[model samples]
Target: MNVSLQIRDVPGEVRDAIAALAAANGQSMQGYLLELVRREARVARNRTLFDRLAGKRVRGLVVDDIVTTIRRGRDDPDRADPDVA
Candidate 1:
């Protein structure tokens, strides 16, 4: 379902700026605003999903310590290959 949206009390300069930006991007003002609205909705949906999963943990999965992982990578003994040089 599609419904018309009306925005009131927008300053002239702000409206003109949006129009100019839409023209620069080769889109009508309505299309540009619709795209912006859709992007914002997607961000809100992702935030909701993360909030729902805030403290729940899956079983049987061990998460490694970050510092230890980095140190192990840095201290690798077989880093250099003799064939490369």
Candidate 2:
């Protein structure tokens, strides 16, 4: 389900600028505004996720070190597996 949104008392210059941008992009004002809202929502969600992850530590598991180890194994398949023994 979707709800309607209404904004009141937009200044003329701002409205005209947005209208012009919408027209230039071959979209109706509604379509352009809807895309803006959706993009902003995605950005907000990403920000919230990053905020939740901030300052949390995983002991002895550096991401760069892991990637390097994987790459080394891929590049040299004859290398002994550290976890095998």
Candidate 3:
């Protein structure tokens, strides 16, 4: 399925900038804008999925505990590999 989209009252400078970008990429304005819309939709979908997953919790695991462990690993010289120097 396909549909048409229309944008009303786009400023001249904004339109010109998009036109320049399309030309630089050897694409028509329609093709460039379509790609932009598709990419944004993908990002939005991924963000929604991430938000859903972030709301779930695992037993015996906490975000602050993970952060503290990571900080300790970085700050503790005794924890560093002796051969890395």
Q: Highest TM-score, which number?
A: 2
Q: How well is each residue in 1-85 modelled by candidate 1, as lDDT tens digits?
A: 9888889999999999999999999999999999988999999999999988875756654456667877787679877755687
lDDT of 2: 0.93
lDDT of each residue in 1-85, candidate 2, tens digit only = 8989999999999999999999999999999999999999999999998888875756789889999988988789788777897
Query: What's the ranking of the predictions by lDDT, best on top?
Result: 3, 2, 1
**Range of the 10 consecutive residues with the lowest summed lDDT in candidate 1:** 57-66
Candidates in order, TM-scores: namely 0.65, 0.70, 0.66
Ranking by TM-score: 2, 3, 1
Q: Which clashing pairs does model 1 show?
A: none
Which is the better candidate, 1 or 3, if ranked by lDDT? 3
Q: Please estimate how well model 1 matches the true structure, expressed as its whole-model Cα lDDT.
A: 0.88
Model 1 misses residue 22 by how many Å?
0.6
Q: Which one wins by lDDT: 2 or 3? A: 3
RMSD of each: 7.0, 5.5, 7.0
Superposed Cα deviation of residue 24, candidate 1 (Å): 1.5
TM-score of 1: 0.65
Worst 10 residues of 2 by lDDT: 51-60
Give Cα distance to truth, residue 1, candidate 3, Å. Answer: 1.5
| lDDT on C-alpha atoms for all candidate structures | 0.88, 0.93, 0.95
